[model samples]
Target: MAYGQGLADRVRTLAPDRVTTATDLFGTETAETALALGVPPERISTIAAGPNPPGGVRGTGGEQARPADLERITDAILAGEITVPIAATFPIEQIREAVTLQAGRHVHGKIVVTL
Candidate 1:
């Protein structure tokens, strides 16, 4: 799934043989764009039944309707099957530093704050 207008086209171009399905998680607005890029209507899908709100997939409702990619990651997190690297850890009092650290270029993973 892609949020941008031309992104699906670019992805299709990257792997024309591999990608058979596409989802416009943002809803019908991009469906035409996907179609224009040669994806069939039957291969396109929306996570929810209606128009999606402003924030795209994140704005869509709960886990039940979320795309498979999100579900996989969530399951992995819950199962402790993956680890999110911690770039730095700070106490709650250092929230500012935490934000600054997150904004920095060298921080590759999450900056965690502890209570």
Candidate 2:
């Protein structure tokens, strides 16, 4: 899921043959945009909070990550099969700055907030 229009637009531009799901967490506009982009109606989904949210689709409760999943991920990291890039890190005191950088959406990797 993308938090802003820029990322969503990037997804649209970079998408390959199949897009399994398009979820709009913020509102209905993303879904509408997907339709405008010729994505089949059934392939789009939206999730938001309000007195009455749009869209009728309901998610089948997704599975929580099991210990085995974490173990496998850890193994991958140890084997150098997975790499996590840190875009920026900030102490808890500079949380506002970190958040502002994150909100800018130009970061290439995870922004770490240290306690």
Each prediction's total of clashing residue pairs, residues at least 3 apart in sequence or on different chains, is 0, 0
How far in Å is the alpha carbon of 43 misplaced in model 1? 13
Candidate 1 lDDT, tens digit per residue, 16-112?
Answer: 8755545444345555555566666676666543754222322234554557877897898889976577779999999999988777745656788
Candidate 2 lDDT tens digits, 1-115: 3445565466666785645555554556666666656666667655552344335433221265576887897898889977777899999999999999999967767899999
What candidate 2 gets wrong by more than 4 Å, as runs, is 1-63
For each candidate in turn, the TM-score is 0.36, 0.44
| True-structure lDDT of candidate 2 | 0.65
13 Cα displacement, candidate 1 (Å): 23
Candidate 1 regions with alpha-carbon error over 4 angstroms: 1-75
Q: Give model 1's TM-score versus the native structure.
A: 0.36
